[model samples]
Target chain A: MMAFIHHFTKTYLMWNEGPMIWTSDVLILLTSIGILAALTYFKKWKWLWTEWLTTVDHKKIGIMYLIAALLMMFRGGTDAELLRTQLIQPGMKLLTAEHYDQIFTTHGTIMILFMAMPFIFALFNIAVPLQIGARDVAYPYLNAISLWLFFFAAMLFNISFVFGGSPDAGWVSYPPLSELGFDPGVGENYYLLALQITGIGSIATGINFIVTILKMRAPGMTLMRMPLFTWATLSASIIIIFAFPALTVALALLLLDRTIGTHFFTIAHGGDPMMFINLFWIWGHPEVYIVILPSFGVFSEVVATFAKKRIFGYTSMVVSLMLIVIISFFVWGHHFFTMGTGANVNAFFAFATMLIAIPTGVKVFNWLFTMYRGRIRLALPMLWTIAFVPTFAIGGATGVMLAVAPADYQYHNSYFLIAHFHQVLIGGTVFGLIAGMYYWWPKMFGFKLDERLGRWAFWFFNIGFYICFMPQYALGLMGMQRRMFTYPANMGWNTLNLISTIGAYLMGIGFLFIVLQIAYSIRYGERDLTGDPWDGRTLEWSLPSPAPHYNFAVIPTVESRDAWWEMKKQNRTDEWKVKEDEIEPILMPKSSGRPFMFGVAFFVFGFGMVFHWFIIALVGILVVFGILAHRAFEYDDEYVIPVDEIKHVEVGLGRL
Target chain B: MTTQTNHTGEAVHVKHSAKQYIIGYILSLVLTAIAFVLALGHAMSFKPLIIILMILAAFQILVQLFFFMHINESDGPPYHAIGLGLALLFAFAFALMSIWIMSFGYHAQLVS
Candidate 1:
């Protein structure tokens, strides 16, 4: 009986011997309880479940993604602050080495996978269909499944912190170190299965967006006439479809090696770790572009609308986008030049890497020319766009410097490399997403984000970004390495480290201000009566702010590059207008609890596998398949919105 | 709720006869048999055997894509063709790059 109790407690509860609970765990517990209590008190469970948990509406799904990404950002940000605080003084023993490893690993994984990917997906959901004048994505039910899969995967990864151990082999999870021989924890198992689930969802998203963009565009909207955002979506989805398969294969092989004693990546059995690196970068490098391309598309839209002119070199912009896509795959080899490939191979990759700058340079000058001799508004989104140019240029220039194979030998794994990537990622992707959020805020909700607070956040964030990373470049030159938890006091790295830590705090404050701004605006901000709040040049602005579930009453036919702008110029809103008798019932997919139930089942399966409980895991798998079969055989999956209901809703909103 | 519309009476889809499917299946089986016999008999040297097997595999793929998958039946949508072409291009690139880089590096290591 004692032995049974010990085994049950150790395996099921994951009760480590000493100090098993942390402040973060307690905080998570309390926050969850508080949320539950509030929901019960307000009697909002039914509203929450029916409206959000089972929603198939693209906009609602996007908002759910936005909320999840923000919560993850806060979690990842706390990890960053902890790192900064520990590094403030030399030889600080605030955290143990083991804990430090887990912190950085989770930080990298959360920031990139959980935060940025979902943030971009949120924008894609809210904006893509609207921009192209489609009523919904091609596969709305599949879209819900994708969101729930990603959500469950993220939850599975996060609970690793409280339930067992966190993965310490870094976000890349390179082999030999991550293998069971060196690190034999269930942490890496969680990483593998969780990523497999999310990766499958990501692949589905790629296919969904690709089919939608290609097939569902309104009449006369030719490929060239498509909005830049849609073009970027198409390009990025292509990359996702092609690149994610490499990740799927790599992860599957690693899973097999760990679980079933395969030699796919095991070094003792004649496996090569470099092969893993190759496969990883094949997916990883393209992933970097996948995150950045949609932001580039956002920048294009913002630059044109704010500048009050046609984008300067539209053909060149499209060409540059495609060129980036083609060139991205050829340059993945540059990531490992220090691994000692032959000079001929290194030279080829280096040249290919540097060639990316040429197309990027064309885009920079095009943005500048668009703003030249044009009426440029200094709106909040435009402010971010204006700041993005110089910062990203510096980032791009440093990128070329590191692309040199010989020079990269010195900068490899140094703070300089860290600084270079953060510059591009934070400067390029983060800034552009913020710009898009602020620009589209009025459309997503009925009110605008408070501009005064937004500018404060903007300046603090931009300035804080520079102050934080610019010195890391110098620190790298001063022989500082990354992933170092502490340093000796007399190494002359104290002052700069302190300054960087200070900058990190300022950025934290900037994020906090944005959060407060959101809360304040939701209650007291002025509402947008006219949907075209910004005098925008896209199809989304043609609808009312906080657009209806069915986006357009009548499907629009495009006639020019900037379709909405052209319609406004010719006063042709009447052209596509439907008479009262022309209104017909619209078919929409019915929302079901299947996706939410699938997520719950996945969590159970993942948790069971983490504990090596094969019986529970098998049961979970069978339940999942049963759900899929149930959905397949049930053909009554859609319902019609009657014409009278549509008329009543539109007339009430004065949109008729 | 509105009554369901019956579109079954409206249009006729093209129907291929059973003979066509049977012929395709028989041809596929014969090609597989020839490839297997050649491999088992050792009728050619290694290099020629590889080339002949590759050609047979290509023929099988074409037959499946045309007959079973109905690639040509997708009418007026050039995007499908373009997407297929792009996918094939990337598949070849992935395979060739993997082989070339690994073999070249392995050979260099051996020489060293």
Candidate 2:
């Protein structure tokens, strides 16, 4: 028992670091305590538990995802600022090398996995069903499970900072360096296990979304007639299902190498580290598309809706998206052309990498032509979409530059690559999601976000983005490699670094205004009484704002490509009208605390595995299985909303 | 209270019999047996042997999918089967590429 206690305290509690308590650590603790106190004081625990923690409703789940993504963005943003501050001047003692490594690694991992992924999934949950005129996802219960699993995996990762040391072998966690001989700590263990768990959730989500989009779309909604956003979701989900398995295999092998003495990626045991790299990028390259493709979907919707144009070249847009997915897998070798994969092999990948630009260019032109002769709204979402075009174009241009096999030898691991990705990811995915949030805010919550404040946020973020990354491209050309904690004063790299840091701060301020905008809007924003807020083109806008619990009172029968637009043209508002006798009781999956409870169990299980406590880990796994068994034996998993109750809801919402 | 069956406006269900499952099982077993025997007995040259084994494996998968899994049944929409087929294609491509890349890595190491 004493030995067990020793292991627990030593391996689990990072609070015992030293006499000096860091300010950030104290802030994290205080913020958590303050949140709990607020919840307790307001007596909202039950409300939170019933409405949020156990929600199977896609809208509520989407809200939870959005909140979590925003919180992760804050954490990742802080890490970014810290990295920037450390690089503000040469010979700065702001952070030690080890701390810098941990910060940057966490920053990258959290930004991509927690922030970008959840943000995308949040949109998926909120919009996909609505766009396709479905009542809910194909598996609402499993949807809750996916969200909670993501939450717990994220918690497992975040707790490493306050409980144990954070993973420092970069987000990629390349082995040999990540192996036990070098790391020998609980950090890489946390990285592998957290990713392994979350990755399963992601795979589940992938399958769930695929089935939902394919099987749950409304009557008369043929494949070609689905909205662009739905099309994008389908393409992205396909990529996720295929690509994520490689990540699962890679992370699992790395875990075994770290824990049970396997050598799948170790240098000495006849294992090649190159294989790990190969597997990582096999997932990693498509993963770039996985995150970005959904954003592409978001942009297509935003551009068409705002431009008041039937999306030009709709089929071509879909073809390009499919083309991107196909070509994404073949270009993983471009990431490692410098490793002497032979000229022929490198040439094939280099050309394949460049081939991506053709389809992407087609998409770009499609969006442009969409706005050519149409009345453009210049709404907040449209502004972000407009900003995305040029910024992502530059990113694509630089991407092609780096794809050159010979040029990559010079540019690889430099700030140029950094600039390129942040340009595409931040400029493309971030902008697109932010636009989606703005566009759909009225639909999700019956109110418009403050456009005045939104404009401020957009300018600051866009300007700050360019200011942050553009100089990095120049700095890379001036021979500044990435991940360096500090440098000699003679390096002449201080000015560009300072400008980049300042721009990062501006972007931080921009994010702050968005927070303020949400808070301010909650109190005083304009209410969207009419369901059709943006004069939107899709089925989502046809429902009342804050759409009724069962999204469509009647599951809408969609007939054209732009189903709602066509309905409006035919003056068909009565399509939503339901005859009194036609009303059937609606059956919905009953919400239960099982998914959240399972999350807690998995967290405990993952925490135990991280500390190598075999019995505790086994117990956690058993608990998870036990809960699954309990759920399985239960037949009454759903409840019917009576016709009278549906009528009551409709009357209350003025939708009858 | 009347027992009201909820109608989601999905297509009518297509039920299958136990005989279909039995046939699928038999077909899968036969294909596996052929591939196993050929590998053990050296029934063909290496290249042709691999090709035949792959063909047999493909047939086995189709039999299982169509017969047992009911890929043809449109539970609501027929696109579920299409999605699965596409997923399988991508998976096959990924596996092939990983092998090709890894083999090339090995070859490069040998030459150097």
Error of 1 at A625 (Å): 1.8
Tell me the TM-score of candidate 2's A chain.
Answer: 0.97
Model 2, A256-275: lDDT tens per residue? 88889999988798998888
Clash numbers, per candidate? 0, 0
The digit string of per-residue lDDT tens for model 2 on B1-112 reads 0111243555555667889988888988999999999999999899999999989988988998898878776644466666677777777877777676667667666778
Runs of candidate 1 with Cα error greater than 4 angstroms are A1-20, A574-578, B1-60, B104-112
Q: Which candidate leads in lDDT?
A: 2
Alpha-carbon DockQ of candidate 2: 0.27
* TM-score (C-alpha) between model 1 and the true structure: 0.93
**Pairs with backbone N, CA or C atoms under 3 Å apart (clashes), candidate 1:** none
Clashes of 2: 0
Q: For residues A207-323, could you state the per-residue lDDT of candidate 1 as single tens digits?
A: 889877876776678889988888888888989998999999988888888877788888789987777877888888888889898888888999999999999999999999999
Each model's DockQ score: 0.23, 0.27
